[model samples]
Target: MMTKKHLALSALLVAVLATTAVQFFPKTIQPAGITPPATAYRHSEETSSVEKPCSNEHPEWREAQMIEGVDIAPAPACEPDNPYEVATSVKGTNNVSMMTLMQTDLAQDALVMGEDVDKDGDPDEIHIKLEVVELNGSSPDGEFLINTYPIAPGIQPGLWVYAPKSRGMALKNFNSMVAIPMLRAPSPTIRVEQGDKVFITLENTHYLPHTIHLHGVDHAFHNSKGEDNDGTEEHAVFPGKSHTYEIQPRHAGTMLYHCHVQTAQHFMMGLHGIFVVEENHPNNWVQTFNVGAGQVRHPSVGVKNTYSQEYDLIYQSIDKKLSQIIQNATDPRLVAQRMSRDYNMTESFENYFLLNGHSFPYTLRDGIIAVNDNENIKLRIANVQRSAVAIHFHGHKATITAYDGVDQPEASRITRDVFDIAPAQRIDLQLSTQNNGVNSYGPGLWMFHDHVATGTTSDGMEPGGNMAILAYKPLLDENGMPTMHDDLLNEVFSKDYYAKKQALWAQGDFKHLLGDAGLIVPPYWQIILFGLAAGLLIGLALVFTLKRKQA
Candidate 1:
């Protein structure tokens, strides 16, 4: 026998009780076809923080090291110093430390040597296994949501590159225990001797489908089994699948290999690399794959006879808007849709330029061509960027020997300071470190960079892009660091410089005239005008309010 008012109050109380119950035990509404992020990948908090011992003797017993706050045993003096530690040595910079990828032997990790048929010494049957890897992409469970591989200081653009199929954690030279997939780009250079029976396998480890088109490499349109040997989109290898491409290259020169599926987007995202066919020679054990393109530590027979050192220079540019789409979500479908359908390359513009997968300062770490006073250096240059690059040498001119895998005639070889290479074109240059003025201007620390202006900048910041030094042995320290003058390194290498926190001419000769004038104040005349405008607006508002009250 409750009144209507009492019944309504009782109902209200019941609703409040139900709401409190729901607060204690809430149900989640999961979207259809979309998996929860936590189930997708393990988050960074789940990772262990134990300090592990590093041994040069047992290099195989190594683990992947987290680049953050990494404190472990020092690398062996015998091996190359950890480029990661070397890069972050500059004070007042929080640049992500480079992965100890160089520690993992490039020759062994990338090249699978097969049986020597003729038995001159080196293996005749070459097998190269490559896997497609996504870099700087987000994961539901990762510490930063994305595993960021910064190409330049404070700039982490998402990229996908071809990496050699490596197993387990990197054992040596790493500071902490991290996975062993040496994910990097301007993907590994495939170096094989002419007439060698090569089997190039594409292991599609990523979520999307991909193919490797051997551009300019001599191969049949179809394989023996009549499969698409041309590596076109017609025969793409999907995720969790693999395909082996067989070929015996007839020519010997620099060529190219890249994904043919969605070529415009895929190529820009960094699936292409230099494919080199060395001159046919007995016992020519070439460093089959130059992962993270730089110096070829083990020179081929023909190269050894011609040049003192060999380098693979691949230049590329990133359109930030397109490359950054992958970082916006953790789902593969969403990213793929955005890149393939939503992105318009014609409307976008390239921002970050790279030389062998790194911008400047970072380039100084491994991109240096350490030369003696009178030495001949062979440089295999490729321009895979959207725009053409006018590569200029600061202190010397180089002689062009080849173009697009074809050797230029001795009479046709041209020597110049700047060489203009178009998109997808390869040019071979013979750099002479002779102090004879024409070829060499007596190199102290000669810088070689793209003269396209934008090519020398990382996101519009000068001294931040594809710039490297041709350091003479004398100028390089025992650790291979160039003995540069002044506090130039201190200023340029800091994060604040790139972040626009510090003024460009704060330390320059024109500091007094052009230095930072913080918190700029408006002129007295402008301030007076603003005050009069404010008074007028206030007077009008008061008049309107009084009229409304009278009404």
Candidate 2:
């Protein structure tokens, strides 16, 4: 039992066990009175009168139900084989004239108004159908399912532009694939002519109640028969219902349409867009709506004669905490309770700013307002956000022609580089790109952004929010995308680069930052190091024990 070989083996075994135990059961320290952060999604204990499951409940389940007899179902998956096939069409007679709006092929029926009663080669009756849709739920890109926009790479809750079924038309059409619902903020811009009999039907497809209030536009409290047509708090269209708003505005300028119910919450939740009413002129057949914002191909007569191109810039700020409510709750009751009752509007803060629908680098992709030398472009800018926005043009001064859909007199119109737009205010500016150092500083990559310092940063990250460029055609790439200098392509400009993740950052160079080397070592190297240390300690212990035994 006291043999040198037996004692040495015993010492070696003890050292090996000690090393193994240290590796397996690492030390942990938790300070007293410390608590972890709360989880992102949480449920409240508030219960409704009827404790029913919210599997397919309407948004206003507690309110008195008004059956409009409309079928509401979840958006169907995109059919790969028959993606752009036309479903059916309907023919109907309106009060103004007998219209033939053809229903095109797509997921949502598009009312193609090809008839011209005025003999001006332009349709006089403007009919548009819109459905409320939820974006970034379950699928970020929805039917597209692909990374359509390479920039702004993250899942976030927002509204989408849905082409609903119109009278005498199916809901799906060819534009459905290109303009798929459930993408980003800034609801589709509704464009109409001054004298055109405008019929905008809103399909309440979302779980919540919504109404399209034509803000600052010419409309009465009631229709011709004294029916409640004014989209206000009283006439809230509940889910699964539909409402057709008939208005023929005489004035022509930039207007707005948004949900009036729960003003502070719903409007800020991205339920508003630019509503442009162009002057009634000969051959003025404007595209009823621009699903999301971009170039207006067929400009109005006034714009066509004056400006070469037109762009709609919808400025909005998002409170991540408020918008995330939709992402957190799956049930309709929970969402309604949290959004209506629990959520505090006073504590709201802006975390993200958007121009059109996207932030900075992404804005450069689609939000770029490309201009040619000596071209006059009409900029219909609207401030949908709560705070006042000071819009500044980098290299040129713009002439303000209209304010709040009302034209300013020529003498009163001011030419300024920075235009101050208050909340719910719209400004129509005529940007002259003469490039003679007077109208503009000669066509280069000029930036157009909010002068408010915070508006330029996204979630407190600089050079990452509502910034866009007004670039000359010469400065653009082969694909018509604007080309910026490498200085703007820094690590901090990237969405994931600021977070310091190796995968999104420098993948090959920043390997050391991936893990804590001291805390987490390679398995093979760790085993070798532990074995050598244990063997050396065991040998020393054996020598010491033998010396002591001899003594």
Candidate 3:
């Protein structure tokens, strides 16, 4: 029933699709089995407790958690919006306030550390001022005044922690560049009590578009009346606008938030943060975490260590070539266009990755963990990406205790050199640097990285992004701990140099910054050759059919 023209068109499409299919076929890997000894693992015990320490009492177990590889560098304290801690005369003990944050190219994806106007141990109020300032020899000519307002308290403390949706960008000050939490988010934490109500208002101060979408925690989109509920399209905060999202996460677990509006770009630009809700009913304080790991030795009435230590290792891959597509957008008109455009999926990619916002060698938290003697730990890992990630370390096998924030004793625990991490997948793995069965391995420095070789690279450099180590060092007296923090190490371990370099590589140098668009596509010239041959054969067959028909 096919017409001659239709058949010919179909043949061409088939050839093109055939070539694509063969060229980009999916690759699969069978991960090695991680079956721990049946007797060694106590599935029946309500608590999985360990009896020995990392050093086995040999005297080296001085520190419970030691960071290897990266030198320790504590980021300097961010400047308060107001140098003089002025407290606003806000009434209620747990008062409520609201503010709108406008989106600007400068404020595009910066971390906001607004002034905590109320001085209630929380950034009671946040100010998001996004506007264009005239340059006077390189800096804003005048006092660039932006709106500052009080927003409602985030997730109540002692309950859950919710990651904010954006970052605050800083301006260059003379020869030095200062970091100002422009988005003005309070801090890296949120507070809550059990059964407490929560309200958050987001004012769109930015010119472009924006919205906040709670990742999990079963929030209602709209109330019975259908107003802008917790999770609804109507809740979107457009440019020069504002909106408040309210929710009560009765359930306890880690949650996330991102700009639902234009998620592809906004989320890629660091619009996501972790929301952890703690279980705090009557007669209960939040259980103490194992410090380094989110492990809880003494579970608070309704709490469990889960996997032990829970760290929200948010993985993001950036294509510097594309970052410039947004970062370098000088003109406001063009910047808005790029942000709103949905046709650039082809240019999207993962050239750089991040763990807690920094790479390895920069991850060592003072290069040590301080525990009483011995302890158990857990790592809450999440692969927040569309691509697959392979996580591997030089030492230790992780027993996965949970996935997607749910405890899973029934799920098989696999220990391997590499584990594939899928997009939006969270894996809770119980880890300990101390090797019980293996005696030869020393309790020292060991490296951990992504098994997928490509995930390790920054926008350009190899073996980059989210690389860190779990250092096991002996707990020493007070003298052993290096002055809590030092300034010299800060400069030495700085990743700013490499981070920018990788971005440059992704841009493909000045010569071909946007270079050939086909670069994103993997080359498979062999597939093209096969496709050509197939096309030739089809042509010959068609010619023969035509001759027969004519006869």
Candidate topping TM-score: 1
Q: After TM-score superposition, what is the CA distance of residue 420 in candidate 1 from its true location, in Å?
A: 0.8
Model 1: per-residue Cα lDDT over 1-551, one tens digit each: 34476456555655554454445432332211112232243324224221111113334222223333432222212122333322222100222322443344332334556677888876777777788877766666453424345565445577889877755443322432222334566688878889888888898988989999999999888776778888999899999999989899898999999999999999999999999999988767665656677776556779889887788999999987787676667678897899898999889788888988877666766577778788998999999999999999988989999999999999999999999999999999999978888999896888889989899988777887898888877786544557763345545554445555555655545468775642122234544455555555555555576577778
- Pick the winner on lDDT between candidates 1 and 3: 1
Candidates sorted by lDDT, descending order? 1, 2, 3
Per-model TM-score, in order, reads 0.74, 0.70, 0.53
lDDT of 1 at 150: 51
* Per-residue lDDT value at 189 in model 2: 72
Report, for every candidate in turn, its global Cα lDDT versus the true structure: 0.69, 0.62, 0.40
Writing each residue's lDDT as its tens digit, candidate 3 over 245-285 gives 66666666555555666666655655555444556544332
**Taking the tens digit of each residue's C-alpha lDDT, what string does model 2 give over 246-286?**
88788888999888888788888878888888887776645
How does model 3 score by TM-score?
Answer: 0.53
Error of 3 at 542 (Å): 62
Q: Which runs in model 2 stand beyond 4 Å of their true positions?
A: 1-109, 112-117, 138-151, 160-184, 484-487, 490-495, 498-551
* Cα deviation of 261, candidate 2, in Å: 1.3
